[model samples]
Target: MSTATVNPAGGTSPAPAADACCTPSQGEAILNAGQAEALALRFKALGDPNRLRILSIVSASESAETCVCDLPEPLGLKQPTVSHHLKILVEAGILHREKRGVWAYYSVVPGALESLGASLAAKP
Candidate 1:
C-alpha cells in the first residue's frame, strides 16, 4: 500500500488515488520498513481465534473494557490461558490495560485499529 504523510495538527493531504475521500483525521504517516514490521507484528497477534474472541467480548460490553472474570464459559479456557491471549493483544498495541487490584482490565485501542484499517484501504 502506498503511504502519504498527514499532519496530525490539522488538514489532510490528498491520498494517492485521486477519487479517494474520507481522508484520515490523523495525517497519513506512511509506514516505513520498521513501521511495517511493527504493524505486521500487531496483525500476527490478532491471527489467533482466542485473541479475537476475547477482543470481541470485551468490545461488546457497556464499558469499552473487560475484566478477567467477565469472559463467557463457552471459551472453555482458564483465566491464565485467557490472560495469555490478552497479553499478546496488549503487546500488539491493539489493547489498553487497566490494573484494578488483581483484576486486570483490557480495552481496544481505536487508533491502532483505525490505522490498520486505513493502511489496508490504501493503494497497493
Candidate 2:
C-alpha cells in the first residue's frame, strides 16, 4: 500500500510506504567496523606530509630500506621529529622497522599499499 501526497500541481500522487525507504539494497559490499577502523588508522598515518615523504624516501633507497639516522637532513626535520613519523607508519602496518646495532632501518611492508588500493577498487 502507498500513501497519497500533494504534488506541486496540487494533485495527489501515491507516495511509497515508509518501510520502502528503509529497505537495504542488495549486492553492495561494505566495510565492517573493524575493517573501517584499521583502514582509518592507516589512512590517518598517511595523512601527514612528513609521513608520506618518509615512505617515499625509504621506498626509493637502494636497498629498499632507510636508516633512521639518514632521514633528518633530507626531510629538513630533526631526528626526533622524523622518528615520530616513522613510528606512526610502523604502527599503521605500512612500514616495517628493524633495529640493526646503533640504527633503526625502515622498509615498506610487502603488499600493504596494494591491499589498500585494492580495497578501494573492490566490487560487490
Candidate 3:
C-alpha cells in the first residue's frame, strides 16, 4: 500500500509507495499513518468471531447497554472469557465501559462503527 500526507493548509500530496509496482494513480490515501494504524487496530479487533458476536450482543441490547455478567450465557463463554473479549472491544473504541459497583456495563460508542464503515466506503 502507498501512503500520503494530507496538507493541512489545503490538499494532499503523495509521500512514498510501499510497493511502486502495485501503486496506482489513486494519488494519496485519505487516511494518514496514525489514522491508518488506529483504523487497522479497530479492524483487527473485529477480525475475531467472538468479538463480533460480543459487539452484536451489546449493540442489540434494548437499553443500549449490557452488563458484563449478562454476556456469558448468550455468548456460550465463561464470564472471564467474555470479559477478555469486552476488554479488547473497549480498547478498540468500539464500545464504552462503565463500572457500577462490581459490574461493568458496556455500550457501543455513539458513532464509532458508523465512522469505520464510512472509512471503508469509496470516496468520490
Number of the predicted model whose TM-score against the real structure is largest: 2
Model 1 stretches with alpha carbons more than 4 Å out: 1-33, 62-64
**Rank by TM-score, descending?**
2, 3, 1
Model 3: per-residue Cα lDDT at residue 20 = 39
> Model 1, range 1-124, lDDT digits (tens) per residue?
4544554565455464544455444645566798778778988987989888887787787365688787646588987798788889889888899998988788887787778778778832
lDDT string for model 3 (2-120, tens) is: 44433356434465455434434484656788877977899999999989998888889847579988889978899889989888998999899899898888999999998889978
State the lDDT of candidate 2 residue by residue for 37-68, as single tens digits: 98889889989998888888888973657999
Listed in order, each prediction's TM-score against the native is: 0.66, 0.74, 0.71
TM-score: the better of candidates 2 and 3? 2
Cα RMSD, model 2: 6.8
Global Cα lDDT for candidate 1: 0.76
CA lDDT of each candidate? Answer: 0.76, 0.81, 0.81
Clashing pairs in 1: 6-27, 6-28
> Candidate 2, 54: how far from true, in Å?
0.4
Off by over 4 Å in 2: 1-29, 62-64
